[model samples]
Target: MTLKICVAQLNYCVGDMPGNAQKIIDAARAAYADGARLLVTPELAICGYAAEDLFLRASFIEACDDAVNRVARELAGLKGLTVIVGTPTHGNTGRGDEAAGGLRTKSMAVQQRHNAARVLREGEVIATYAKRELPNYQVFDERRYFTPGQGICVFEAGEGESAVRVGLLICEDAWFEEPARLTKEAGAELLVVINASPFHVGKGNEREVMMQNRVRATGLPLIYAHLVGGQDEIVFEGRSFALQADATLAGRAPGFKENMFQAQVERAQAAIKIIATTEPERGDDAELWDALVLGVRDYLGKNGFPGAILGLSGGIDSALVLALAVDALGADKVRTVMMPSPYTADISWIDAREMAHRLQVRYDEISIVPEFDAFKASLAGEFKGLPEDTTEENIQARIRGVFLMALSNKFGSIVLTTGNKSEMATGYCTLYGDMAGGFAVIKDLLKT
Candidate 1:
């Protein structure tokens, strides 16, 4: 069987069903007009990915179902196309028609999020598959929302370049081996996945590399459709691609843009073309910078912080933190405070002041020696036998921390901690001193 499939990698709005549905309709129409026999869309293209609490609302899900039904109605007469699109499918028990028994046993009982891909052929629902492997780790809580899908759905389409059987999996399923193994066992000639995988710099190539391994392992051509757009603190860069049964990249769509393209698979090796493709020209370093830029911007913006305040120690960590904050939120939105102690280097002060000025950020300095001396006098009796080791060193830091926190509170700005993993791991940081802040910028990094 020869099949030509189009994956519509679209950008979706979190709560804008009407707007998202229009885009889906337009893309479907365009792909059909371009002679695509199969149309695939990214995960939750209709309802949007990570629609967090929105999924918990029956009205919101009803909107999604209406959108899917509308799209099916709009494309009802497309005689030769099979469209696989992601939508929040509703079920009384959140279970599909297919199951060994009505009982969703032990492990299946944990999380009950119902994420599904609806396959529409000539304007009617053919089959649906619930997502397995609901990621519950950091940033993902599908287990709390969606129940594991009951079974895999494979079907045959005769409208492709040639006819073939294909299997469908949602985002996480393609990452696991059993889903693909079962797909093969079910005699699926092709495997297609819908994902809302976010980009964090070098993540695009990582997805592709994994797909290559998955293709090699399954002996099947793979089609991956990913979401594209900036959502909250995360941006989904849809670098959608396809691999031949042997794991050769057959076609790819661009990132950071709405795109759609088709892959034709035939019993005999189809004449795949190497059309000059222009990707987002993103290098590892550039991607990392972009991700960081987005991360800082979204993290603050979504959390409702008006601006950021940081203690500019003139060290490498502080300098970098200042730059990132200024870049993410405007320079006018960033403020830096330099607290100089007796042990502080002058060059540190000079560098930090200059950088903050260059970035057009408001900068100020507060001397802490007077207060440090007072603290030492007050703690003299408490530290009678204690020979000042790092204790004295930390008092200076604590004073500065207090100064920064005071400035932050007075200005209604958030304190941004500048400690990196190296300092954090070695305990070079003083809690309630350097470690005190509303936001710890580099908290998740490992000590290098």
Candidate 2:
């Protein structure tokens, strides 16, 4: 029996049980319509991953339970389909509570369900796989909430003589070597991994690399399902992929977009079939450009920032910053100023103005020629014995800092530093000169 599985890579809002349940219903219906007999969703797909303090609220927990039960009923009509979804199940109190206040009735609570997988067949839960490994390092606190599950579960899915055995795993379980080993040990022919992995720098490629190692270890066809969108400071890049046992990438979904994939499995050992992954769309500049745009849009929207401003120098770095800022925040919200020096080339001023006009960014020309003369006169006596040095150069930078800070203080706009990685790495940038800003767009960025 050849079984068709659909991996529904979805981005769910935390604490939205009703909305999430609807998504589940929609995805299941869509996948079923597309000839998928089995549908897999990410961890916390029903209630949203990492409900945080909301999990502490009894009302929220009850709402999730309600949603789960409703989903089971919604899925019941499909005779040949099975769904494996990750959710937080509430038991009465402890181990004995399974029979007490309505805890996990089935042997589902692995160690203690900090993480759980509900296996729904024909709309009713037939079995569940609790996550055994709990990550506790950066940004992970699962050890505080869930007890690790110990057992493994593999089920058959397909019609006719094509029944294919499959293993199910939550996000972290696929990363470590043990879980995949155990799943294969349990007689699973294929692997399904549902994840809510957070995004950071270089995370998209990192996930692909990690998945490659897992596929090689298990020697089984694998599917990686992930979430897309932003939650708070973290963003999820959805690059859902299917890989063959030989570590060949078959298909990959585009980054930051929602997609559904169908995987067909057979009884005989054949090379894994990839649904996509042929074309590399984004170029080097384009990827960085998109990343910058995404970072700016998400940062401002998430933190409730109103607008932004930047000092535009004729220098290459400042020009780059000005253009990137305009691209990110739009012309209406971006404002730029060219604080010209006597040494500033005439073409510098012309280029800055043209760029601003082209981008339609708000432009201001604040010349510091007179101000520099006034300062030179004031410090002339104190520097009587000293030769002209960078000390004098720093004074000019400080004066610009004071003015920009004042503008920011008055207008409620954030001052963005125009300095790039090169200047900051060597500390060639003055403290108040180019280093003045509310957020470092490239804090982790290296000059190289």
lDDT for predicted candidate 1 compared with the true structure: 0.78
Q: Which candidate comes out best when scored by lDDT?
A: 1
TM-score for every candidate vs. truth?
Answer: 0.72, 0.72
Query: Whole-model Cα lDDT per candidate?
Result: 0.78, 0.75
- Tens digits of per-residue lDDT for model 2 on 1-448? 4677787777677777888888887899889888888888888787776676676655776787788778889989987888877788655433556464666554644333457778888767877887877888877788777767777878877666666777888888988999999999999888888888876656777888898999999898888878765565455666777787777887776766566766676555544443444325465456566666555655665456788877877766667767767777788998888888766789988988988898898899998888888998998999898998888778778777777878888987787776667677778789977788775565434555
TM-score of candidate 1 on Cα atoms, chains taken together: 0.72
Location of the lowest summed lDDT over 10 successive residues in candidate 1: 270-279
TM-score, candidate 2, is 0.72
